[model samples]
Target: MPNNPPIIDVIIPANNEEQSIGHVVREIPGIVRSIVVVNNNSTDTTAEVARQAGAEVVDEPIKGYGRACLRGIAYLLNKETPPGILVFLDGDYSDYPGELEKVVAPIIHQNVDLVIGSRELGIKEPGAMTFPQVFGNWLSTRLMFVFYGVKYSDLGPFRAIKWEKLQILNMVDQNFGWTIEMQIKAAKHGLQYREIPVNYKKRIGTSKVSGTVKGTFMAGYKIILTIFKYL
Candidate 1:
């Protein structure tokens, strides 16, 4: 294996994403060594679509945001040699998979440990992000600055990390706080991290977390508590 061409792995946690999952999978850079799609108990044909798109599909029967991610990460962990870079993106197609190179390049070519895709810096289509979600991201990111001393914008699902270093995070969130949990742990471990702009657009379907009031509240509470828990 050439040292410059790191083995790249992409994990997509999908739930009923038949409409756009296929496109998302296809758009992922071919330079990626492997693509893992965690089908989280979708009633639709997400698994079939992803498989048809040449992505390895795994089942996460339990329905939790983090549940699917944990399952996917476990699959990666079991691999003989861990990938040099791990990229996590939503299967809903809201994030531009083509921009993945920009997100992972910092960690792959440089010495960064984590790279966050910041929607705040990128273009967000109209109605792509709900008002509450925008506010929530702003508020939560501000809290992180005040409490954790780390500055960040949107906790957009599109992100990347060093595979070996990520395992030490020991993330335990089985719900919406998975991103924040990883962020908190990264801060605690003092990992080198950076954020870059990534384009965003409206998803083909409604968001499971932000589409419903109850789900949004639960997500906000979980994210806040996750940060507080570490602090």
Candidate 2:
């Protein structure tokens, strides 16, 4: 551990989340050194709203969840003093941004390489997650445990990781497989990881991936394919 407190930065990948991005950005904990919001080719005012909320906004014209996250990483890496820890969170308001401190606690104090915020273990409001979302998480996690021998509860979007370890993962998923890809690679690399409970609520708007049948199917297919692709 460094003599000084480790710097922590947050990355939020947003697409057409103008209505909720500001709240997400503003609710993030004060411990974070910086907040970078990647506007993923949104036709709305997501970028402006995030900037107005005192977050650094970067544009990712190509719309993919992982692509937006990668852009945020690139922005951070270009900095002279990149953060020691990087947190990934959705721009949607479902996640409790204030619990970021709890989410990163293990990495900050216990030398943990990764920390996943497990909504499955948390207090969730009614209708916070759809039936398909719940089922997908269950099946995907079970498959990962069977294949990779790592137990994961939910591939929740809110997560923290050591920046150095994260770069080593060479993350490349451009869409739905981003979170699972990270979890799978962490296990394969033998990184120390933990899941901590984090409360969830209904998002400010409909979920892009789960609100529609087509989106849900495509996301599920991509996640399952990615799981097998790595095997």
Candidate 3:
């Protein structure tokens, strides 16, 4: 570890993730300074549960995943002490929050600009991912490799980025295109990045992006659209 520890913050975009948000918040490592859970117009007690679980809550009336993440970013922007490394994870409990150290290790040690936790390269529990989700990752990553000259296996949600480098990307995707937009922009900007294996399991409730037909279609379409939007 560096002599002066890095200040870290987490952002979780949640929509009706009442059953899983508490566990996700609790499982995050003690190194984190703050956990910001952006409630994306959830009808349940998602906001209350997150606040009770030790996360500072931000209400975003919009339902888009990227919108909720942006809300969290906006909250962090006003913080007195800015973070050194910023992490993004899901509120659905599919990702092992305890393994955030693994996600951010390269940034803390090797001076990497961005790190993505790849479920495809990790120990995924049975039934953790549906067929469509699997295929979409494969296609998207391949397209990225072809176009950007960078090899990436998965577009997993668990990711970390240096705070300074993140601002240069100017992320604007407001929905399913968020993750890919970051990856593509990082490559274009010549930021060093890596994908490490991360443990993944079946989530407590249905996944908003992969559980429904419409969600899957839109997410896939948006991811592909995002890959080419920069070109």
Candidate 4:
């Protein structure tokens, strides 16, 4: 491989984010070689808007977060030449696409395998996060430290990981537990990881996972179960 890496493939998992998809797509740094937006069975014009804003759209007719992410990764895996860094971001506009450098810089410039965007470590727009998300992050991170000797805060979707390293992690969480699954597996696999505070704002619409009582409970349950499954 050349000393200067060629490109970075960005995978955005989105569902019904038509209102914000266009802006998010356009905001991704121009240095990104390919932007893949996985429209996970959206009921709106998310795919169309993303395409209009210059993103390669991939259809993932799945409901879970991990399912969509896996589809995106699979696309890159089958490509002629896989990208050096794979960035994962949500389409809900909660994450700042303009800050992509911060999430991927550690991996590209410093040889880190993973970089996570920590929302709790920075300022959050009003209503950007709910009480359950805050508590869940704290409780789950505590559990990771207690059981697996790993530590992370704010399982935010904005993150980046080296392509080959991510493939080796063998991640398998299919739903709300996806973030923690990768984090715990990275710890177990001993990948060089780091976290940086990132700015987050309230999404264009209500969050499917955190806006409802049932969703919140199920997410918490799944996260706990995912951790225990590894232990």
Residue 155 error for model 3, in Å?
0.5
CA displacement after TM-score superposition, residue 101 of candidate 1 (Å): 0.7
Alpha-carbon runs more than 4 Å astray in model 3? none
Which candidate would rank higher by TM-score, 2 or 3?
A: 3
Candidate order by TM-score, decreasing, is: 3, 2, 1, 4
At residue 141, candidate 3 shows an lDDT of 96
Among these predictions, the greatest TM-score belongs to: 3
lDDT of each residue in 48-69, candidate 3, tens digit only: 9999999999999989988888
Error of 3 at 158 (Å): 0.2
Off by over 4 Å in 4: 1-3
Error of 2 at 9 (Å): 0.4
How do the residues 55-123 of candidate 1 rate in per-residue lDDT, one tens digit apiece?
999999999989999999999888898898899999999999999988988886677999999999999
Error of 1 at 110 (Å): 2.1
Worst 10 residues of 2 by lDDT: 1-10
Q: How many clashes does the backbone of model 1 have?
A: 0
Alpha-carbon TM-score of each model against the true structure:
0.97, 0.98, 0.99, 0.96
Pairs of residues at least 3 apart in sequence or in different chains that clash in candidate 1: none
Candidate 2 residue runs with Cα over 4 Å from true position: 1-3
What's the lDDT for all of these models? 0.91, 0.95, 0.95, 0.89
